[model samples]
Target: MNFRIPIFSLLMIGFSQSAFAQIKEEQLILDRKREPEIKKIEKKKTSVEAEKNYPPREKKIEDSLNLRYTVTDVPAASDFKTSTIQGEDISPKFEAENLNNYFQLGMGNFGRILADGNIGTKLENEIEVGADFHVLSTSGLKKEYPWSSKQNIGNVAAYLNANGEKGKFNVIADYGLNDYNLYGIYALQPDADTDLKQRTNRFKVNGYYDFYSNEILNNVRLKTSFLGDHFNAKESQAEIRVNLSKHGVELPVGNDVVLNADLGLNLETLNTDFAILQENSSKFLNATVAPQVTFFNGDSYLMLGSDFSFLNAKNSTANTDQVQENRTYWFPKAELQFAAADEFKFYAGVTGGLQLNSFANLLETNPYLLSDQQLRPTETKYKGYVGLRGDIDQQIKYDFRAGFGKINDMVFFRANDLFDTSVSGNRAAYDYANSFSAVYDNGKVSEVKASVQYFPLANLTLDAEAQFTKYDLENYEHIYNVPLLKAGIGAKYSMLNKKLHLGANAIFSTDLTTNSFEITESGSQPNVFISTENNDDKVGGYADLNLSAEYRVHKNFSIFALGNNLLNSNYQTFKGYKVLGAQILGGVKISF
Candidate 1:
């Protein structure tokens, strides 16, 4: 027990010494942090002690452990502020006005009058229906002649269209009437007025049905027409057509391709009473099949196809048991197109087809035809062509084509008595040699065509085109009424906030061969006639210029003026038919 007390006392002494050492180290750390303040405090103490002359006292444990801290000042922040914002006002929208219905009226010199109008409406389910009418007439011209030069034409049409999902269709019905006096050839009969005045009527119905996303069968077309003149010349026809297309068609040596075919059937009946032709009426039945295949590669495509057709013809007035004429044809429709760039292409192709001719078509080509004219089909044996189509730049585009064609049964217009001038004639209204006759011949034609379109400005467009054709007729002395060169220039411009529109076009045609005949009295009692032919005689070689302008005075009203034959010269359209002087017409147009 005595030994333990000494050991315990010794341990307690060591622990007290360790604790005192730690407290002293903490005081030293405080003195180092504020050494200047501590020195000042010590100096003040010494001064006080010296002034009072008092003895120094020993410092205790509390004095050694005392600590002090300094506090720093911080500035205050300002108040928060924000500005208010206002929203902009929105403009009201108005619905657009309907301008589908329109009308036009005009009057001008040479006793001209024009009137036309149209009205239409949109029905439910994407359907549209409309009707329109047109009328034009001219009354006074060439008073010095014994005959009257008067013309009148009128037309009316109605249409219905429907657009559906993956399919669409349209149907149209129209009628036209044209009345005029054949004053170019004056009649020798005392009452020629009754024979000279004639009228033509035209009626037609056309329809089309199409499928947008169809793969096998895509489109169908139907047409019916009846056209006739006062001279018992009439043509009535009905036709139906369908298009078949298929994609992803498998091939033996290559990938899938596309196949397309077009099938058609047509029937026609015609009638004509001629002074010379023994058979003046006919009937026709035509069937056609066109099939094509398209092979595609990298920027290149080849379309190979052929058109095959069968035609049957018979005399309209003949007995039902009569044998009909049967004809068959095959035409190539092949082309290879290579795209050199995005906007340019080079293509070469061969095409040929048969065109059926009728009195209506002949009348359109030559208005003066004998009623007893024979009708025949024009056969295009072959037409080979090479073409380049591309855009020059952003604003200009161009197309150039050169082709050669061989045609059979090409029709030409010739004077009535051009070949035969026998004194004894039918003495009919058209037998006076003043009328024209249709002549057919086989010929070869080489042609080159070029066209360019330039959009110089946003609202202006300029177009120019030229065509040159060289004809080769074997054994025929002349190719009548065929122009060697044809060209035209047209321009359309809109200005003044797009309220004024101006259009101008000029057409130029080269000289053509025409038959010139002269009549001479060879007898005193019978007044026998002798006709002479001028083989080198020619007609045409004129530039026809026309200009039109329209100014929209209001949203629904416009003022328009047009000047035709602006050169102020006589324009001969046919061999003996000449148009009046420069015609000026002014009118108003309305939109509702």
Candidate 2:
């Protein structure tokens, strides 16, 4: 009975304990479910509180302002104590020197003598006057050749120049006399001791005037000349030239046009008488009018012009033969120029004209010509040329030119024939080997020329020139006495503060064709029966070398020495002629 009661208490206690465990399990499940909802609500409340505590902030700005500044007045200048400093003098000093007049005298081998004098003066109003005189004489080298060779030459010249507000004026007068003996025939006629004397005199007067006005006519020139020989041959010429020119005529192409006109009048007369040849007289009247137009810019230029000439000539001889010619000729001249750079230029031209071949000109070219030569005018039909000139580095200069021309009645020198038996020795009187006769030939000529100048230093200079000429004759087989090639070179040097100067020059020429003759005697009067056979000869090429040196001893005094033909080459410039060998001259010069 007691066992039943204990069992019931145990059962009830166990049941209660089971019910409490069940209740605890249910609460744990409910807490797990409500944890997420509680956390969500707390997070929402924290975000709202944070937003309310820290509201949206306003934007901030920075302030920048400039400060004002006041400038003070500058301090007034103050006066300091007067002061002076003295030092050694350092100024430029100059010496005055005058060397307008000079006198020179010299003597050398072969009995040669030289004398020269020059004087010049300047006056108020820009007037200048000057005079010059020179004399050169040489006697024979050998006594046996007394009549073989002798020479005397003298010249005098004076000039006057004046400059005024209007323009310039100049007058010049000159006279020259030359005397020489014919010695070319001495080798053939050694026993015949006859002195053949020849003398020539020339006189000239020239006047020039230039006007500074703005008119077209600007310049005028007048010239008169007279030439005479020992054989009663006389020639006179008078010429007048007037120029009209206008410059700076603007053109549409930004160039300038120059219009120029030239008017010239010339009158010439010649008279001569020979023992064997008849007397001859010639008169010529020449008038020319030339008009030209030039278009020029700074770098290029072109010139176009034409010359119209009216010539009237009359030639008469003692044999009642007369020739008269009156003609009008037209010559066209044109030139083109271009400057490629500052130191280079190219130029070309085509020109043609008639040149007067007067007796004075002939005598000047060949002093040994006989007085009985005929006179005529030379006609150049056409001449065309192109040339280039330039400088290199401002120290050297060069020029090259090539040209072709056709000439009618070109004159050349030829030996005369003296063997005519009918002249009764009259032909021999004037037919010496030294004498030359003028001959005419029509031909075409071509020439090439080149020149160069170099300055290696401030006081040294050198120059060289070369030329080649070719001729195609129409009627003749050869051109007589004309060299095919010519060349020259010269150099000058100064040193010792310009107190010492030296100069040297050399010239070369090719061989020339000339006529010679062989002497023959017939079986009769030996003196009167001389005859000659024609033969051809050649004058060999020649070179001439000359040197000079000078040293200044004082401010107005100097000593100089010169040597010619230093190589002693026995070369002849003309057929049957002999030139002097080495010759030396030394002298002193005084200037004041």
Candidate number achieving the greatest lDDT relative to the actual structure: 2
Q: Output the TM-score of candidate 1.
A: 0.76
Write the residue-wise lDDT of candidate 2 on 1-592 in tens digits: 1123223323433433344323211110000011111122222211112222221110000000001000111101111100000000001001113256778777666677777766877777667777767777777445435454668877787777666666667777888787876566632554345666778788888887766552576568787778877787777778777877554455665344433333334443434333337667777788877777766565566778877888888888788677888999888799887878746778899898877777667765566677677777888888899987766787767777899999999998888666354424333445655578888989999998877667667776666667899999897778888899977666555656776655555667799888876655566655544546354578888776665566678988876666666666766656755666665666767877
After the best TM-score superposition of candidate 2, give how far the Cα of residue 117 lies from its true spot, in angstroms: 0.6
| Candidate 2 TM-score, true structure as reference | 0.79
lDDT of 1 at 149: 63
Off by over 4 Å in 1: 1-98, 186-195, 248-279, 297-299, 315-323, 418-428
lDDT score for residue 288 of model 1: 73
Tens digits of per-residue lDDT for model 1 on 1-592?
0113223323433433344323211110000111111121222211111212211121111121111000001001001000000000001001123266788787776677778776777787767777767776776355534556677877777777666655666777888787876655522322435355667898878877666533667567777778877766667877777867554344565543333233333333443333343436667777778887666443456778887878887653332343469999998888787868646868788888877777766876676777656577788888998987655565766677899999998888887762344556544455565577777889898998877666667776666667898889875777887788877665555656767655555567788888866667667546466767677777767776555556678999876666655665554555655666566667777878
List the pairs of residues colliding in candidate 1: 274-372
Best by TM-score: 2
Error of 1 at 9 (Å): 99
Whole-model lDDT for model 2 versus the true structure?
0.61
